[model samples]
Target chain A: MQFQPADVVARASFRLPAADSAEAAVRTCRPLQDELRPLAVEARAAGPDEPGEGFTVEFLLKLPAPQSDDVEGVLRTAAAPLLARLGLDAGKLDVDVEDRDAIVWAGDEALSKGGTACGAYVVHLRIGRDPDEPHELLPEGSLTDEEARALTETLNSLFEQRPVEEH
Target chain B: MSTPAWWDELMSVSDALAAADRAEVAYWRGGAEDGREDSHEDDVPPVTLRLAALGREFASHAHELTAEQQHRFLGVLEDVLRTGSEADGTAVATGFFESLLNAWNGGFDLQAAWAGVGAESQACCLDLNQFWGIESPEWMLPRVA
Candidate 1:
């Protein structure tokens, strides 16, 4: 059977020295999401109580199965120019497609597990993905050469953490 | 003791904007883990400095807030950050005030959802980065705790 455009989920994690550094990273990443907005039916921003630090961002990109190979390929291509501009490393890049689900939920559900205000405000797809015959576009794996190089550079500054300030 | 009317009003507006921003971003990100304060610094618009100031004012008065008052304070905080600025700021502000018209009409425990701050009341704080199928910030795992 031919693949349809909808079964792709991109979940990525980032580590910075401190929460503030993470915030900077997210800001840097926003343009990436904005660029994908037209291509993907949905896009969003999610993280825990703190804005920066160690955060995980997840977004669903809808792509045709014929272009399934292009899913990761596109990300790899996208990562290069962007990461290069930001000066981050591609080798240390942490990106992949971990699951195949019909509907992709924005934000991590784990935060709410402890009865905390951890609800990062999960953003639903601006457009929902089809459940039946969902097309799983990208699978978790290594990024292309360019992606690797760019990610390694981005990581150099993006993940460098700082001390959390006392409230 | 009664909190100042102006303080209450400021709290209400600040909370509304913050919650709205938070909800909208989360919705867009597709339910990714969020809680770190650092993540928001970039996402928030420059105008948000106004709201942040209000948040600071609210925090300063934290000592004066009752348990219920504090809960209400935190409850709206989530909303302001999640959905406030993305939507029409003026409209959101108006809705917040309108909701407060009968703020106590049918509700008293709006605080239930936001009872406290810190880890117990917050989402997971992120300190690491992963992308391009590789994880970085080698110090992240050890620092998380």
Candidate 2:
């Protein structure tokens, strides 16, 4: 089976630190923007309840997943360059397959305890989503490379969290 | 006291969104515990899709909202996050607004969803974001207890 162009697309979104300016956020994401492809980059000022949220950025990158099973592999490839640019300390990265039927991240890491089932393809890479305010991101020494890799594995498994489907 | 019509609409929007999440929680719990299958009847779209549509709807109408509407919106969320309705000294689940705010600031990328929707609607979302922020400086993250 082959995936449609839509299925190959995913969006990554996160907020920069509250200290950064909106211009910096846009400039930072500029390298990922491509006019010829499905890639889209956007940055906008945030509305913090207090002040100093700075900005948020989102990128819709189209992966080369011509085959249905190529989804996970493409996602992994996409993540490396993105993380290298956005860096791990950026914030919580939420990536969701544009396809309607993909399994998603409902903020639950595990299944409901029976066997396993999947929903849509949405994953929240917990960089700094825990802070009560935008001013406090990831805290200090909060995230590790190993944990990010593990979370990426969990997101890769479309059917179950058993393991990253060896595609 | 009677609530304004917009308040009711906002309530419905938030309630339906909450109900969707609650249903998802139930589906996960129900399907796993007893091995029951997913209901074929509720063939709704993904929660984010539904949320995006509803949020866009809110944004379009947001500019028309009055101060009373804003007060009610802020008051209800504040009451939940601040004092909260308690039963037997146990606080209720107030994740609806927190989750909604997270949509604005957290992982959901709501503003991205509104891309090309229009400048006014996007402006309204930002206004709501600022409103929530100023009204509750502790608005971004979900509150515990």
List per-model TM-scores for chain B.
0.31, 0.28
Q: Write the per-residue lDDT of candidate 2 for residues A42-152, one digit (tens) a residue.
A: 344444431225455444444443333454444444444444443332133334333222222223332121111211122222111211112332334556888778767
lDDT over C-alpha atoms for residue A150 of model 2: 72
Give the winner by TM-score.
1
Clashing pairs for predicted structure model 2, backbone only: A49-B133, A49-B134, A102-A120, A102-A121, A103-A119, A103-A120, A103-A121, A104-A120, A104-A121, A104-A122
Candidate 1, residues A1-167: lDDT per residue as tens digits? 12234333232223222223222333444654565432211112233553333433333334323234444454444444433333344443333433223121223333233111321222211112422334444334778988878777988878888889999
What DockQ values do the models have? 0.02, 0.03
Candidate 1 per-residue lDDT, tens place, B6-92, comes to 334444644544455455445444454374444542332222223333343344444556676665655554455355443223222
Question: Total backbone clashes of model 2?
Answer: 10
The 10-residue segment with the lowest total lDDT in model 2 chain B = B85-94
